[model samples]
Target: MNTENARSQPPHEPSGCLTGVARGIALVVVLPVRLVWDALAFCLRQLWRWVLAPVGRALGWLIDVLLVTPLRWLWEWVLVPVGRALWWLVDTVLLTPLGWLWRWVLLPVAKGVWWVVDLLLVTPLTWLWRYVLAPVGRAVGAALAWAWHIAGVISRAVGRAVGWVLWNVIGRPLAWTYRVVLTPVGHWLRTWVWAPVAAAARAVRAAAREVRVALFGGSR
Candidate 1:
């Protein structure tokens, strides 16, 4: 049985070491192809960079030349002339006639208004001053003088009572108002009127300085 089994298992065929040799040859052949592929990729990248650089610069220069320079020139030359022409047309055609109309028509109307205002305000004020306020003020002065004598006698008797009432009721509020609002308002009134005067004085001073510089060699 053992002899039959040995005979049935045929001898192992000779191993094929040629497959390993074929694999080594294939690896050696692929190495140069991979190197060439990597070299081509690098060259393509370098070429892309070189080409894009000039294209970007040219695009930027074209934008400036086409859009920016012409716009600036238009603003400086064309727009200015157009604006001046429009202004001249307005002054000659529209504004001149309007100004004439205003002088001829509207100015008389304004004068009429001023006359009416004077009649309403100044005439009444004058009449009141002459007829009512002046006589009433004189009468009040005379009456006050008479009352002052009587008041002095009574004040001597009731001085403490009047003083207490005024101190409690009126004096504190009056003092507070003077300190908080009236004092600042008085200061502001002086400043408001004086500031313009000061500005005019400063302008005069500047003109004098200029004149001095021109005449005296800036020594003053």
Candidate 2:
């Protein structure tokens, strides 16, 4: 009855010797794995706090001391002076002469030429067209209208001849060539050639912008 009662109740705990053997196995296997994990964690923490952090700070300080400060001084002192001198040389040599030519030479000559045209050519032509030519043309037209049927035919023929002359001299072919040839050619050049060149120019400008940012520390 007691055995049956024991079986019905529950299983008993392991003996002390078996428990001792199990603990020994755990010490051999799990103890070393835990020790290795703790050692790795400790090494990583020391490396980050002591070695890597200090090295990063030292590299930053070294870069500031060696490279950045000297470049700034060189840009401020040497490059700025050289640039200013070159600009001054160009202004003195190239621009001053052009300005003098405009102010003293070319300007007076152009003014004189324009005055001559206005006085001799334009004024005379304007007076002739308004007073002489326009009056003669109107008188001739009025006389022809009163003459006969033959005069009407002659006037029509004259009108057609004048129109022919004007069309041949200045109208359709020049307009056609501009529309067909020049416009399309200009469009093609703008699309294929100028577009690519403009894109490359923009890329170069962007690279220059990056250089400026680096040189000026990205502030101004």
Candidate 3:
């Protein structure tokens, strides 16, 4: 009976030790698994943050491209058509009559102004020149002619008086000098220079006659 009791006690003590070791192993495994799960959740959260950040940027870009671009394009389209319509209206309605008037009426009137200028201004100027300036020029010319004639008369009278005095006072002496001095000089020049020149001319004539005869074989 004592052996049976000791065996039972030993078995019970080993069972309790096994239970405690099982509980400790379960705690260790569960703690590591929870840590792994928490790390996985954190990684998933970071990945989702990275992906959503790019998606938000893409959405913002799409909004700007879709809304702002179309709005700007529509604005340009509306403004361009309005500007063209305004320009067309101005050209066709307003400027057309102005251009026509400038071409036909205003141009003709401007050209006719030259004719009016010729009639009103040029004709009067020509008449004034002929009527007023011609008489004045002729009167001035006649006065100048009269003045010249008076001066000529005075000059002629003075010249005649001077001539008479010079004739009386100096002409006799000059004539005596011409007779005394020039008569001998003229006779000497005629005797020396003219006689030599005449003899040389006769010699040249004789020489020319001999040369002609020699060249033409005595001419005969």
Task: Highest lDDT: give the candidate number.
Answer: 2
Give the alpha-carbon lDDT of every model.
Answer: 0.91, 0.92, 0.90
TM-score versus the correct structure, for each prediction: 0.33, 0.45, 0.34
Model 2, 126-164: lDDT tens per residue? 999999999999999888777877778889999999999
Listed per candidate, the RMSD to the true structure in angstroms reads 43.1, 41.8, 28.8
**What's the CA error at residue 126 for candidate 1, in Å?**
1.8
**lDDT computed for candidate 1:** 0.91
Alpha carbon lDDT of residue 88, candidate 1?
98
Q: lDDT of model 1 at residue 206?
A: 90
Ranked by TM-score, top first: 2, 3, 1
| lDDT tens digits, residue span 115-145, model 1 | 9989999899999999999999999999999
Where does candidate 1 have its weakest 10-residue lDDT segment?
A: 10-19
Superposition TM-score, candidate 1 onto the true structure: 0.33
Q: Is candidate 1 or candidate 3 better by lDDT?
A: 1
In terms of lDDT, which candidate is stronger, 2 or 3? 2
Candidate 3 structure quality by residue, lDDT tens digits, 1-220: 9998887675545577898999899999899999999999999888778987788889989988999888888779987888899999999998998999999999999889988999999999999989999889999999999999999999999999999999878997788878998888898889999999999999999999888988886752
Which pairs of residues collide in candidate 3? none
